[model samples]
Target: MSQEMGVGLLRRHRDFRLLWCGETAGKFGASVTAVAMPLIAVSTLHASTLEVGVLSASAWLPWLVIGLPVGAWVDRMRRRPVMLAAAAVSFLLFLVIPVAARTGHLNVGLLVVIALLTGTAAVFFQTAYSAYLPSILAPEDQPEGNAKLHGSASAAQIAGLGSAGLIGQVAGAVNAMFANAATFLFSLLCLASIRDREPRRERTTAHSKALLSEVGEGLRLVAGDPWLRTLTLFGAASNLALMGYQSIQVVFLVHTVDLAPGAVGGLIAAASTGGVVGALTTRRIAGRIGTARAMLLFELGLAIFALLIPATSAGAGLLLFATGGFCVSAGVVAGNVIKASFQQRYCPPELLGRLTASAAFLNYGTIPLGALLGGWLGTVFDLRTAMWITTAGVPVAALILVFSPIGRSRDLPTAPRPRNDPGYVHPHSEPSPRSH
Candidate 1:
């Protein structure tokens, strides 16, 4: 990596800079709403825990339905406009919430619909952003770029959680949603400032595949890949455990731990600090430890952290929660970097968008199930007992990766070379002024 590229990434990489700023704002605001939304449903709308679970599922449900077709569509176009449109629509939707609430027209049904729309729009934005990232930097610089993205994401998670907690406490939940909406508006403005050119593809005249068939093709792509198949399974299992825990987390914090509502934000921030630290160090760690060892190390750490959750089942205070959060975040950051680097190499460029969406959809599809299970269990069993049931699955999920080649492989790409996949632009092809 060039010294100049490193220097420029701090604030240069104009497109990354703008995208980062906008996304960071969006992420932070979303974190606030993550807490506020459920809190509002429970407190103001008098929704049941199961209803909250359904709402949580509503947010992720779109991925299961529209994930693949959207990927195919996204692949055929420049991503920036798609990203901009998604953000704009989401911003508009969020602004409507405050107006409705103040007018006494806000209802539980409306909030669910809003959550669903926001999540659905987020799918397009996220997939496009992921696809666009690789073409932005040098091939050798990818690990560095990915690490920085993760770091920004972690930092945003922390800021969002903290801000949400503070706002939720001071302004009340309804007004707090408005504050998050304002952040989205600001994010749109930041996106507009980023001027990096997207890949120019001539509009294709090929007939589009049927929606379900496109979804099937995406699934077939993953199934064809040995590594991706394993990774997909691991991701699916991990979401099951994580979502299960998330389902009851709010109630646990409110009822069992006796911590104020703001404490969840503190816990999220506490764990996200580990993610920030891990993301900052990932490139160096990959260089030093090699990719395969890093994967195993992160997974083991994840399992240990998962196992330690039951220790907190006895109420080890906030320290236990923080420890769990830290390890979880660290493991996730390390694991994702490895997965992303591998995917960029393995998945064909023409199919990258769909394959990624397929994987995400399959993985996330389990979330609603887990959420429903958690809510029912938490409602029936005590908090500690419900937690035990949930935590048991974490080690199992982490260990599932042990059976995959990804956990045992260490190769990391240091160059962007063309293969059968010709749809991608090799950013390394053009000499950057910052090239070493």
Candidate 2:
């Protein structure tokens, strides 16, 4: 598709517009919760650094616990209903938080439970949503769709993060959760309004497979493919390092850097602007420098800025954190836009749900471990020392991409090599498709 065609998709496509709005709204709410949850634990309950880390871990733990099966299940059912249920569940769960705080019933344990349950809902919604997108847009339109959705998500996050601290300061941290709940409601309404319907999937008895068998197929698909394997590994390693530092960032800024709540929100919102830029420019960058080269530039080249995060201090030094964060955010978001488009085109539509879940299982599974590691490091040593260790791992993790076939390629492959092609090299000699 032409650039002009992609840019005009939102205007021409009504169902896609609804999907974009709902997804963007959902992202906005999640971003608000990201700031507000940690703030509540720190400011309202006086949570320790380790407690904050555990809280962060709780939110991602469900990915490890149920990711595979959920993917398999989602493929068997229509995606929209699953997303609707998940959104409803998330809305109610977020709604309960402020109520509990007001009723004097809020506690760390309750918070943990809420986080875990909401995370479960997120798993279903995300899995269903990933699969559902391909059904809405034609193959050529997917890149622009992914770019617009990711860009809008980043923009919504900026708005959410910018507002979170003001809400916290004015209405109290616990009550700020009301904003999150409201966003989910908006998302639900938008989703319910979509006019297009997904045709029901029909499975013959001979084609049916057990859940575990389906899960294994998904796992093997990712593991056996060179491109998917390489990208998945890079994502896993990168997230480990990313979440490790992020899990403790609030504590590092609040306690070590001595920033107030509102200042903290403003700084993070400033840093997140990079995501918006990255999303807006990714398609042009890939067009200019091949998609594979763009991935290397974004994932390996820009990630070097992570080292500056540890250099953050009180006043003038805070720019160090923002600059580093901006680069990392830009790189990660741009790379994701490329990757999302690649996957939509490359993978078989039948297995997209499984593919998403299987990849995410490995990618997000490391998050809890990273969070705990950050917490343990903070507890065992000091917060700054922990930050130094974790932030340093960011660029190092990209070395996986460097040693793999991605480093040598100009563009990622458009389709998987035929299974019967005996001449295929596991990580080399793959066919390159026309550049996006």
Candidate 3:
């Protein structure tokens, strides 16, 4: 295990620190929007339960729509420019929301448009950012870098959630979006300050491969590799359930639990403190129990508490929601910490963008569907019953991870199986980078 150097990276690595600050700012902004956007739809636009689901779905729909091509594009070009352009687009989209709202022009349809456009930007930024990280840091420092990044993101989420409510209550949800817009500018400034440049992409004769063929190569890499396949499948299932509940959680807290709009943010912020706890403890727990086993403990074992969410009522009962949400956040973030380290070590650098996009396509593609499902269920049955159905699937989804090879081993495989083996090439072998 690496020594807990604490401030070593922050103090010594200039470029990493810039990237960390940028990412932290971006996440904080996004978390605030996560709460404020829903509040706008519910409170300002008078969006129905179903419309809110559609709004949530729209934000993630781009993953399904543009994911494959974006991955291939990220692999072929410089990542930083892609990230810069994406951040700029997100900044403009968010800036327009409050402007439109103040002008008496905001509506559910417009909100969906903003969500879709911003999400499209996210597709580019997230894919490029994932691929860009390794370029900024040496292989040995990546685990430490990832821990700090994830821990800071979790902390930012907590702060953002806490502040979103107070800001929404005092300033109104429309103006609160100004804060999200500001964070993007902060991110852009930080990104611009980074000193390290990516090595020029290596060129090769393999450039002749069709773009679709390149996309197919990435898909096959994940499909043919057992470790990647299991994790991808588990991610898809887990996200489906996670998004389902998330899409309607605001409705449950406000309408079902009868909480004030301002109180919603604070309670959620309190629950998200668990993400910070999870990120901090993941390395230690993995060191104690091994990474693969720790994954099960995090995903399958602790995730079971998600059922307690629907059981929440008022006053004392809200504690049930808080506790359940806290456990779920902790488990999910801890598992993510383990997974990020595993993927970075196991996969080839060139394929990281496509691997991230392909996996996210499976993982995040379901978000829209889950949002729609949760909304539909909430309308047909009731918010509380919908909550029950959706939250229950969270633990049940973990069974996918448990039954796969992840459950049988103490650690996930760090290398591909032998070439002649079933889980090995054609696609498992790393491909040379080519100018498209």
Off by over 4 Å in 1: 1-5, 204-214, 310-316, 412-436
For every candidate in turn, the CA RMSD to the true structure comes to 5.4, 2.4, 5.4
Instruction: Tell me the TM-score of model 2.
Output: 0.95
When 2 and 3 are scored with TM-score, the better candidate is: 2
Please, what is the whole-model Cα lDDT of each candidate in the order they appear?
Answer: 0.73, 0.88, 0.86
The collision pairs in model 2 are none
Top lDDT model: 2
Candidate order by TM-score, decreasing, is 2, 3, 1
Tens digits of per-residue lDDT for model 1 on 1-436? 5445656785657877777778878887887777788777766787877787787777888888888788877777788888888888888888877889989999889988998899899889888877777766655656667776777878888887776666666676777777788888888897777777776765553235565676677787777655567778888888888788777776677667665656666666776777887776666666666665566677666657764554453245567777887887788887787778767765656667787788988887788778877788877888768777886787678776676654544543334334444333334323234312
RMSD of 3: 5.4
Which structure among the candidates has the greatest TM-score? 2
Candidate 1 TM-score, C-alpha based:
0.89
Window of ten residues with lowest summed lDDT in model 1 = 427-436
